[model samples]
Target: MPGLLALVGGDEFKPGNEEQDRLMVAAAGAGPAYVVPTAAARQGPDQAVAHATEWFAGLGLALRELPVLRRSDAMKASLADEAGRGGFFYLSGGDPGLVAQVLRDSPVWRAMFGAWRAGAVLAGSSAGSMALCSHTLVRATWPNRFRRRAMEALGAVPHTAVLPHYDTFGHKWVESAREAAPDLTLLGIDERSAAVWHDGRWRAAGPGAITVAKGAKMTRFESGAEVKGLRQPARMLPGR
Candidate 1:
């Protein structure tokens, strides 16, 4: 069996979300739970790791911080080898576009994929979550020409775009995204919440909820509720 996959909305490593992290730690087992801060490269990756370090410690799990801050670092053989030591791996928050750009087809990502296939828990929060999917919405930055758009991703979880931090301002961003591409499925996940894959079904984890809307019909799943009929994404199992 492939291990757990957590797609956290935003506000990762925060206190209220311990319910999901506890499950991750339990599933992770003895090996180190590596934290890859690649997405936070421009936004103080070290500080994010430090924050995560304190948070995971409280959960009694020590994290191996993988400092793959740039695309160059993602290709390193040394880091790739080190990544295999992880029983659980987390891709923290930052730029969705950069995370996908850096890690896709890289040696370190291959190792991480191998680990996840061997039953290691692979979790990603916010930008990390978006990059894990087949397509993701890139947040506006840089210049007027570089506002935002849907970009292709790694496809660990296929065929969807996530709107993180949904309970608040994240919902506001979705309108522009929906208008830009009306066909795409937007999974609006609330902050401090996560959509988790387990036991052949999707579960609404943590304090907040997961919302899926189709036309005028909107559906919401509260915490611990089973998300019925939600499209199940491909897993990193041993065989297809």
Candidate 2:
């Protein structure tokens, strides 16, 4: 009944947490952890599998790749059975829009939610990480051209937008996020470092930091905060 969601920004998976990672590799009781790499590999599934394999190895867990992003009922049923039965679930970095469009309103997405509620460790990275909020900051590539809209996120964390590659990338994210969802908590996760979330508290680990941007008031925390005391601002884009 306990789950861990390790939402990574980007990093080479280095073996860590030997036992914990091993348990994750075993996928516990949730069958084999579902690896959803739909965001990437519109080109091919091998890329996604490569990424997942490396990530799991770094986490000290071994994973079997599902390698499919279909919204079919059979896939949904399989995912539901996995959640009801037992391991972990992971989403590799790629295109957030793709992930959303492919999995939106489908049984697979629904099953994921149920698994999370049942305490399934749902780890992800980059695009995968971005798609875990109620309001997500999709693409922030074109500086001033930054745009954002509401999509059906995983709804795991409400009133939040995950800003990955915070420190690694320049301050572009800061500007874009400020223009997009200025009032929400913009969790700027750095590379190598992760925001380990559980029991409503998020603690940063690894050799990096996390930035918490709430409107004009923004600050970075080496160790992230719990969901509580995380000031929720009004739902308005910046310059309101």
Candidate 3:
């Protein structure tokens, strides 16, 4: 049994994200929740974990912090075993490249993946979301804030990429994202919002909307709505 999958825009552990987190809680059952603050290693992982624990506590989930801040931490068999026991696992925001580099082929990631494959909910916010896909847009190493380079990711969701914080800085990367992975499905999720995968379709959640960018047009889907494109090579919808 596969569990829920969510890619949230930036601003995790904030006021606006409660709605979506609540949804995760309902589907999560009684198993423990784990927050992987690996991405926030340089940005203060302890603080990130604290925030996650506090936020999820309000949601009735006493979240455990999987503080695997380095490659060494990721390789520890004990840490990997702990990662495999969670009913819900969250990857919080920070430097996406660091997250990928440390956890890409590590034991912790493998254990976490097994848990997810066995029906544990998996969600990532901001850079965490970006790194869950097949390819991630790398920005930390570059001097220019707006410029990004494509790099390998965990590939939990194949042929897909997310632009978190769309209402803020994410929209600026639209063209760059397209150039990086033209064949991939491009999703622009607004801050505080999320696109969750249940079954084979994606559903929009939270206070904001989700945008699926295609060619010269962008379509928006409000919360509770399923985001889908018209079937190709078929009867067109008016001029579309």
Candidate 1 — which pairs collide?
Answer: none
**Candidate 3 on 1-240: residue-level lDDT in tens?**
667778898898989998789878777734678999988999999999999999999988889888799999999999998888878999999997888898888888877777777788889999999888776787734666766667887878766677888989898888877776677777788999998876666789998989888766789999999977521111111112
The TM-score values for the models, in the order shown, are: 0.90, 0.77, 0.91
Ranking by lDDT: 3, 1, 2
Higher lDDT: candidate 2 or 3?
Answer: 3
Query: On residues 55-151, what C-alpha lDDT tens digit does candidate 2 reach at each position?
Result: 6667655676654465463256766565444357777777766776666555676666666656677766777777766566665455543455445
Compared with the true structure, all predictions reach lDDT values of 0.81, 0.61, 0.81
Off by over 4 Å in 2: 12-30, 54-60, 70-75, 83-86, 140-152, 223-240
Pairs with backbone N, CA or C atoms under 3 Å apart (clashes), candidate 3: none
Clashing pairs in 2: 27-87, 29-86, 30-86, 30-87, 31-86, 200-227, 201-226
Segments of candidate 1 deviating more than 4 angstroms: 140-148, 214-216, 235-240
